[model samples]
Target chain A: MSEKIKFTIDGKECYAEPGQTILEAALDNGVYIPSLCYLKDVIPAGSCRICNVKVAGRFMTACTTPVAMGMEVENDIPELNELRVSIIEMLFVSGNHFCPACEKSGNCELQALAYKYTMMVPRYPYLFPEKKPDSGNKKLFIDRNRCILCKRCIRAVKDEQGRSLFAFKNRGNELAISLDHELAENISDELAEEAMEICPVGSILKKEKGFQQPIGHRKFDKQAIGSDIKSVIK
Target chain B: MSKPVVATTSLAGCFGCHMSLLDIDERILDLIELVEFNKSPIDDIKVFTKQCDIGLIEGGCCNSENVEVLRAFRKQCKILVSLGECAIMGGLPALRNGIPIKECIDEAYLNGPTVSENTEKILPNDDELPMLLDKVYPCHEVVKIDYYLPGCPPRADLIWNALIALVTGDEMELPYEVVKFD
Candidate 1:
């Protein structure tokens, strides 16, 4: 068995394997750390910066920082939460995230995080950037207006040869997540569904399957995001 | 003491938020008892008779008229609450924000396929008509918005809880189930 490293998160004693990151360790110990980019088993991108935690006076991305013995991490605190909320607000304003018209309303991780943070109104002014939705693919569509650029779909959705189906097209300010048309055409139904599931926002949606889940019955409908971990810890 | 006076308006919205307010069901009776309507569609009060304690604004500013009414509400009310997505983020009408105002006007009046009867190609620019803004703006952008309830049309329970909390001067309880974006 791998050696376990002991750490303290928000004053709670926690243990994790030597190779695990702080976020993984916290979740393993049933501690909830709100994250958007870091998917389980996938390499940590730390792009979203939503899972930032204070470690010994310096802020660190929990998903990128590895667990260490005697490490003191502040997970759930007012300061960190406020910072996270601000990031969420920035994402909301920068994107044209009209949740009422979005198909991934209740299931979207970004929307769920906004709900968890109780984001009544974003502080920043809305950009309302001009973006077009691509519905050319048979099974899936990419709505650029709602994309938060978390890069989860780009990082996770892959073909049989380990080639990425989704990739970033264009440079900064004009950056957009684009699907490889050739690869997308042959994408299986299951993969298409997974792509939709991996997206943090309502960017990637599976065609012909929307609003299938009724209100009050979808994910994050009854409980706030990461509540399961809190319940488990209790 | 006299009841708290309340006013409400729908600027660039579908009045769905008002429908949600009525969704408070028979509890609207409790609301009527708790507060008196000043300037609202419910009371048919065309103008504010007295200063209001609370102003529930349902929609964002999409035109000069919306801005004017919003400013008037801000002047008349002590607290202003942005009700629903439209009031908070400009919602569906804001979808036009990315496009140029000229293009939008042209599409609607002169060039759109739906326009079948514009042989003279005249645009509505009368002084009586409210001129559209370059883009839709959230309520907070125009004036100080004290509170915001975000939903397509904010849930009935959310509206009720907010009003009750505001009137009673108690901390608002935001249950996870009630605070949804859609």
Candidate 2:
């Protein structure tokens, strides 16, 4: 068996394999490092900065940084958490996040994070950028208005040929996520559901499948985003 | 303490937030005993009779009249609270924010699918009519909003807790389940 690398996260003793990223090792050690855009089995995108942790007095993404032996990392300090909250607020203002009208309001990760942070209102000015929705697909609709461009769907959802079902189109100021012609062919209900589930926001939605769960029963309603992991740890 | 005078208004909103306030149920009796209403649809008071301690504003500013009323609320109330998603972030009406103002008006009046009655294409522009703003603006964008309770209509319990805290000077308990955006 390979020797485990020892590390300290918020002064708690944690162990990791040589190649394990901070986030992976944290999970292994029953610690919850909040994240978006980092899905299981998919290559880490490190795009969403929600998993940012201070390492050696500097900030680094837990999802991408490999754990180093004897490295001290700060995970849930107030300073780092405030930064995370600001990012959540930025995401809110930069999109048309009409949570009241959203189908994914109760279950959305972005909205859950905002709740976790107790963000009463975003400090930044609302951008209100115009974008269109594509409902041409039978099972799904891709609403770019709410897309944060986290690339979670582009990274995770794939076809039988190993092609990404979602892709980033256009450039800066006009960057958006688009669904592949994978929808044109026989797209499975499972795949449509997966795309919608993979999205951190309500951008990817299974058409006609909204508000199915009651208010109190929805995910993250009674608990926080990473509460399940924390509960297991406790 | 004169029962912590309270006021409320609905601008470009659907009045759902006001209905949620009423959803406080039997607590409405306790709330009325604790605070006084002024310039609110709840009491059918069209004008502010006096300065208020708390002002709960629902909806964003979609027209010149909304701006004027919001300014009046700010000037007359000591603590102004944005009471819902519409007041907090312009809500659904703000969907038109990215679209051109002319395009929006033209579509609503001259070119929409169900607008068959107007061959003359008359747009309401009387002096008494409020002029449409270029885009819907959140309460804080127009005036100083002291607090913001988010939701389509923030959960009734959330509203209750906030009011109780304001009236009793106690710390508000934001239970995760009640603090929803929907």
Write down the C-alpha DockQ for each prediction: 0.84, 0.83
Which residue pairs in model 2 clash with each other?
none
- Residue A224 miss distance in model 2 (angstroms): 1.2
* lDDT of each residue in A1-234, candidate 1, tens digit only: 877898999998899899899999999999999999989999899999999999999999999999989999997899999999999999999989999999899998888999998888888988888998899899999999999888888889999889999999899999999989998897899999999999878899999989999988899889788988852344
lDDT (tens digit, per residue) of candidate 2 on A85-194 = 99999999988898878888878899999989899999999988888889878888889888999989988888778888888999999999888765435788888888
Tell me the TM-score of chain B in each candidate: 0.99, 0.98
- The TM-scores, one per candidate, come to 0.97, 0.96
Q: Name the runs in model 2 displaced over 4 angstroms.
A: A182-184, A231-234
- DockQ of predicted candidate 2: 0.83
lDDT of each: 0.93, 0.90
iRMS per model, in Å, is 0.8, 1.0
- Judge candidate 1 against the unseen true structure and give its global Cα lDDT, from 0 to 1: 0.93
Report the number of clashing residue pairs per model.
0, 0
Question: TM-score of candidate 2 restricted to chain B?
Answer: 0.98
User: After superposition, which runs of candidate 1 have C-alpha atoms over 4 Å from their true positions?
Assistant: A230-234
